[model samples]
Target: MDSLIKDAVKSGTPIDGADGLLNQLTKAVLERALDSELTHHLGYEAGDPAGRGSGNSRNGTTPKTVTTVNGPVRIDVPRDRNGSFEPAIVPKKTRRLNNINSVVLSLYSRGMTTRDIEAHLGEVYGAAVSRELISNITEVVVDEIKAWQSR
Candidate 1:
């Protein structure tokens, strides 16, 4: 993939426009971030001697597709035997990327109900974010909204 990027760069391929190289780049970066998060949560990197025969280890990965502005990106989410690790970059059972939180806020600010937003995401982004998930995501922005309003 590195070589492919290098070739594209050398060939003067434009980096941006729509459904271009940036989407793939975003996917790669997100996957790497998830892997790093897992490594940190485990307290031992994969293949480390300490993790060998330990009570828990990397079990495998589950394919998860996140909806991005670029489009849908499929990523292999790393898993552990204990299943205790919850990814901060993209939480479990949440299909949309964290980047879409702003869009969620914007829609909610426009007086869109949770159900409305949920259906919109399902139709547009192909994400099945639940009402509870929308509430949790919007709850974070509630504080931000208060702070901004006060200012």
Candidate 2:
């Protein structure tokens, strides 16, 4: 166990909030999962020494914001040089998950402005959604609505 978590547990601190031990644990888990998922996608684990001559090796990571049911978090998402890997846990370009998107759209549909949605999401769900992100998500919604209307 991490010392912080251990101490928290020993001290009887609650671990249920966005800034609690559980949140930190979730971040670590997501990061490690992304790293390993990249490793699997590349057909070699990181630092294996065998990937030195491979065509596609570890190309470093990009900072990505992911919103889970627990809260909003920033995670380092690993990538490859080939640019073919599409993360299943959180796909490329789409910041929020379906559940989060539903919540965002629901609030937005209820006359909440983009800034209001951003601030409310950050405060309530720990998601630091950027204005650009909100626009992107809404664009997807717009496209879907267009298609639906046409149908």
Candidate 3:
């Protein structure tokens, strides 16, 4: 990990951005986590002889784009032939990850408008989030608060 950080710095890779070292690292980590999930589901490591007679094997991975606190990361999610591998880290059919909704809510609580939050995401995290999406995230929190108050 130290070597990778040194190499990235030597190459002048930006610390944070859409195409920066952090984004690349996040992608690598998420893909690795997904692969680990698949291995746990299948009960064998990739290319292990123990999986020879296994009824279910690893299928090719499917590419998925998910939003994270770092930015929008494109990761190849591993799949299983049995079609039962549900990743706990990223999950299936879910795009946003890494508590990004929490970030939006925190900003909203600090009196940042949806438009301001949208721009902040784009500028800081390289995420091109729309105002509507930010508003929707905040609205969910507002509704939850309202429900809690009524109780």
Candidate 4:
């Protein structure tokens, strides 16, 4: 692990970008977590004898592109024969992850405009987040604040 980081640094790899070390690390971690989730759901690891006669076994994986804080990561989400394995790290049909939302909200709280947040995300993280998406993410917090005030 230390050698990998040293090599990445020696090669001038950027910290955050599509092909950067952080993105690669994030992708690896998420994929590993998803595989763990599938194993838990199936009650056995891949190639285990216990999975031979199981009603629901490992089928394959589906390619999914998820917008994460590092950038958009293309991961092969593991699937099951019963089609009931739902991953909590990258939930099904969730294009954007929560960390990016938190970043947007943190920027907004610091008085950055939606457009500014959009440009910051694009420039810093290489994530093409639009102003509307930033607004929508912050809107949820706004609603919660309003509800709290009303209460």
Q: What do the candidate models score in CA lDDT, each in turn?
A: 0.71, 0.67, 0.73, 0.73
How far off is model 4, as Cα RMSD? 14.0
What are the models' TM-scores? 0.56, 0.54, 0.61, 0.61
Prediction 2 TM-score vs. true: 0.54
Candidate 1 structure quality by residue, lDDT tens digits, 22-82 = 6655565566656766776777877899888778888899999888777787889999899
The sequence of per-residue lDDT tens digits that candidate 3 reaches over residues 41-60 is 78888999999988999999
Evaluated against the true structure, the overall lDDT of model 4 is 0.73
Name the runs in model 3 displaced over 4 angstroms: 1-7, 99-151
Clashing pairs in 1: none
* Root-mean-square deviation of every model: 11.4, 14.7, 14.5, 14.0
Q: Given candidate 2, what's the lDDT at residue 67? A: 73
| Clashing residue pairs for model 2 | none
Candidate numbers sorted by TM-score from highest down: 4, 3, 1, 2
Residue pairs of candidate 4 with colliding backbone atoms: none
Report the Cα lDDT for residue 74, model 2: 77
